[model samples]
Target: MPLAVYLLGLAIFVQGTSEFMLSGLLPDIAADLGVTIPEAGLLTSAFALGMVIGGPPLAVATLRWSRRRALVWFLAVFAAVHVVGALTTSYELLLVTRVVSAVANAGFWAVAAATAIGMVAPDAKARAMSVVVGGITVACVAGVPGGAVLGQLWGWRSAFWAVAVLSVLTLAFLVRVPAGRGQAATGLRGELRVLANRRLWVAFATIALAEAAMFGVFTYLAPLATGTAGLPASWVPGLLVLFGAGSVLGITVGGRIADARPYQTLFAGLTALTLACAALAVLADSGPALIALVFLIGLLGFGINPAMSSRAFYLGAAAPTLVGASVTSAFNVGNMLGPWLGGVTIGAGLGFGSVAWIGAALAAAAIATVALALTLRGRQPVPAQARA
Candidate 1:
């Protein structure tokens, strides 16, 4: 990998921190802005909705621009929006900033993935992607917690200020990003045509299902850790640290195998995910077993990103940028849907441990989706260009 690839990862680290730090700061934001916690929670949802709605159009609009320029512009807007957010006292204004900042953030991610892959060899795409996506896991471990501490010490606004500073620092590395000579410009019509493929849509759905499986259980992990696992409230932080560590390890292992054996890796990852969730569903009351399963769930749950992203790249070779955007949109959609589904399960009187069952079922659905894609590949004739 080139230095540019690592810099792209660093940019993701900044964006990921800003993206997730909102969760930690919600209580402070709610109190200060005179909104309920649920209303403050809407800020998080608004950011995700912005990402889902904004990524593709942004990708299309920036088709003619150089990836380096797009990246720089997006980060500049992101930093600016965070500054505005830090200064705003109105909840309504804060919500607007969150959405606008997320638009910028979505555009940055769409370009970043394409840029990262473009800078690496075809065989190294998964490894490169792992390094980039690893930024999010690192954010969960360090950035979110740090933001909470910053919020406690100074104010919630301080967390936003810190993110803005990091974004600015990250922009300095954009000079290393390689310049392009109009490849994106030449593909407008052909790239748009790629959207017609049923296979590509299936690939998008697969990514969504996989993420839903992961987040369904993850969104309730703290509660599960305390209630079912019988751990102390203070242990939640350590549990988060453990999960993040497991995710990093999973990404590393998945990257090594995904490029050459994408579906094999997919099956392996989902299988591990299913088994881990199933164990949690059944043995969550046993402290030792619950602890081990939580770590395994974290490891196996996130371990599929390389395979999943690699699959998207393969399916969307005609429009890599759109594929990048699609992946981002799909993940956010899953992020929202997963927690909602888990919430429904709990509201229906299934305990927190039932979230693991829901998660396992979601993973099983992903596994079946992968199998369906493979079956369709065998039964249906490949498009001439696809075959080529």
Candidate 2:
């Protein structure tokens, strides 16, 4: 892998830390800003909404720009918004900043993924994606926790300041990234034509469903651990750490093999994920079982990510940057849908274990989707460029 790929991963790490650290800072932010906790939580939702909607438009807007320029511009915007978010006392201003920052983050992600794939051979695409995704997995393990600790020791604003500084540092390193090659030669209309491909949409559906399966259970893990599994509150953090650790391992292993065997990788990982969720549903009363299942779920769930991501690039080969945007949008859709569905089950008085069951159902659906994608992919003629 190129050094530039690792640098792109570093950039993702900084942005991802900002994306996730808000979960830890919401309480402090609510108190300081004189809003309800739920209201403060909307900041997180706003960011998600921005990510879901922001990517494609930004990708098109910057479609003609050099990858290096697009990335640096997005990073600068990300950093500036965080600085404003850190200094702002008005809740509304802070909310606006979060949305702006998320837009910038989305743009950066699209450009970076396209750039990473551009730097690598077609056979190594998944491995390159793993390096990029690894940054965010590491963020989940280290950056989120570190930000929480920073918030507990100082004010929550301190966490925002820290993100701003990290973004600046990442921006400095991004100067080394090459001005990417093989941009879509056909202008906007030709690039947009790629979206008409049925296989590409199947790939998108598979990714969204897989992520929904993962996050449905994950969003409710704290309650599942403490209430159903009988673990103490302190153990919740440790369980989260364990899950993150498992994710790191999953992504590492998945990256190495996904390019060589995309369909097999997706099937195996999603099937194991479904089984893991079912096991969690059945064994939630046993603390040890719950702990083990959490790690296993994390491993199996994230293990398929490289294949999921690389599929988009492979199928959407004609429009790499726009496809990157679609990948981001698909992921955020899953992120939102999973938690909302889980919340519905909980609100309907289904036990916490219901989320695990929900996860299982979603994973099963994802497996079915993968089968459909494979069947469709087999029927479609492979592009000559892709064969090379």
Candidate 3:
């Protein structure tokens, strides 16, 4: 992999660590901020809201800038926001910081693929992207668990501080990126025109609902581990390690085959996800079963990422960057919706395991959506550009 690609991965690690660490810190944050657990959980939703709300506009606004410049600017903002987040004692201020950090995070992810594509050989684009995405999986494997450990040892704020430090180092590594790519501004109307395709919206909905199934169960994992599975609090990090390991394998394999069999990957992944969720719902109390199911859940949940993304781009080839931004927005919408739905289940006295059952339903729904899209696809002809 190119040095720039590795640096981009490191940047993603910084941003993703901050984004995911909130799950591990929920209890501590709830006590420190004097908020209910549900209220603290909304912090995840708020960050996703920022990503959903900010991603596309940021992509369009910075369309003409060098990808490297846009990336650096966003990372700088992200790092600074973490500093504010770490120091803030007020819950509202922390919430505001999460939103700001997510806006920056959204912009970074919106441009990341485009930047990676620009940096490497054409044939290497997918490989390069996998490397960048691997950073996220690696973060799940290490950074998040590490953050949890830090929170357990020092305080929740220390996780934010560590992410800030990582961001600074990533910024230093990014000095190698070029300042000029001669990228011209795309017309807003032209980009918006891509949204008119029925198939593209189908793909977006598929991504949203598929991810909703995963996050719905995942957001409450700490409680599930403690309350439902009867695992010790200290065991959470190890479970994350297993999940992240599964994710790494999933994404790596997905990246290799996604170009040729995008839909197959999507179908298979969602099917696996559905089964995993259902299994978790029934067997969560069994220690060994929970551990095995958690890994399978991670594997299936993230396995199709490359295929899902490539499918979206294929459907929206007319506006690649906008497609990227739109998909990022869609993923965060699922991220927000998942936790919100999970929280609703708990509030309604459905118990923690119900979260997994609901997730299974959502994944099944996504499978149906995929089947419908496939049916429509068989009836309709592929666009020549999309075929290319």
Candidate 4:
């Protein structure tokens, strides 16, 4: 890996922090803005919606631009939006800022993934991806909690200010990254054509399903830990940190093996994830067991990420930037879907433990989706032009 790859990861770390930090600031935002807590929560949904709808179009628009230029522009926009969000008194304006920030973040992610992979050898693609995606897992562990502490000390706006500052610093460092368009710098038409690949859709489905499964359980983890698992309320943060630690470990290990044996790695990780969810559903009453299962769930859930991401890039080889955008869109779709499903289940009077059941079912579906992808790949191998 080159220094540019690590720099891309650093940029992602800053963006990832901004993405997840809101979980801790929602109450403060609602109180300050005179909105209901649910309305404040909508800010997060707005961000996810923006990412889902904005990424592919942004990718297409920037297809011919230099990667470094696109990245720098996106980072500038992201930093600017956060600054606006930090200073806004109107919830409506803040909501718009969140959406704009997410769109910029999505654009940056799409370009960054393509740029990082372009900096590395083919055989090292998964490892390079792990380095980049590891930013999010690390954010879950350190950034979210740290943001909460900042919110407590100063105010929620302080956290937003912090993210804006970090994004500017990251932008400064990212200026040194290479400025070339990636290998698949095909024009808009060629990139759009890649969207017709059935196998690529299958890969997207696998990624989406896997993420839906993981987040279904994760969204309600604090409640599950306190209500069902009989843990102290104070223990929730530590459990979250533990889960994040497990995720870092999982991605690290998955990165090393995914390139060598992608399908096998997916199978092992998804299967373990399904089992972990099932175990959590059944053993939610046991505090120690619940704690262990939370860590295991995070491990197995994120462990498959490298394989899924590698498969997307492999299948969409003809349009790396567009495919990267599509991958980002698919991920946010899952991020939205999983929590929605969990909320529905809980609203229907199912216990928090039921989310684990939902997780299990989603993971099983993901396993089946991966199998279909493998079959599709076997039937129609990558075209020679794409392999070029």
Pick the lDDT winner. 2
Order of models, best TM-score first = 2, 4, 1, 3
- Per-residue CA lDDT of candidate 3, range 1-388, in tens? 6678778888988888888888889999999989999899878878888999888888888877778789899999999999999998899999999999999898888788666655665345456667777788998998888898899999999999999998998898888865644235446777787778888888899889988998888777878899999999888778888889998998888778776677788888899899999999998788888899888888888887777766777777666667778888988888877877888999999889889998999999999988989988988787665766
Local accuracy by lDDT, each model: 0.84, 0.90, 0.83, 0.89
lDDT of 3 at 239: 84
Per-residue lDDT tens digits for candidate 2, residues 1-388, read 9999999999999889899888888999999999999999999889999998999999999888899999999999999999999999999999999999999889989999999998999999999999999998898899988999999999899999999999998888988999874354768998888888888888889888889899888878889999998989888778878888989999999999999999899999998999999999999889999989988888888889999999889888888889999999999888888888888998999889998888899899999998898788778897654666
Task: Report the backbone clash tally of model 2.
Answer: 0
Runs off by more than 4 Å, candidate 3 = 30-37, 118-127, 178-185, 379-381
Q: lDDT at 222 for candidate 4? A: 87
Expressed as tens digits, the lDDT of each residue in 175-210 for candidate 1 is 888865324654768777877777777778888888
Which regions of candidate 1 are displaced past 4 Å? 181-187, 380-388
Model 4: per-residue Cα lDDT at residue 122: 81
Q: Note the clash tally of each candidate.
A: 0, 0, 0, 0
Ten-residue stretch with the least lDDT total in model 2: 179-188
Q: Is 1 or 3 the stronger prediction by TM-score?
A: 1
- What candidate 2 gets wrong by more than 4 Å, as runs, is 181-184
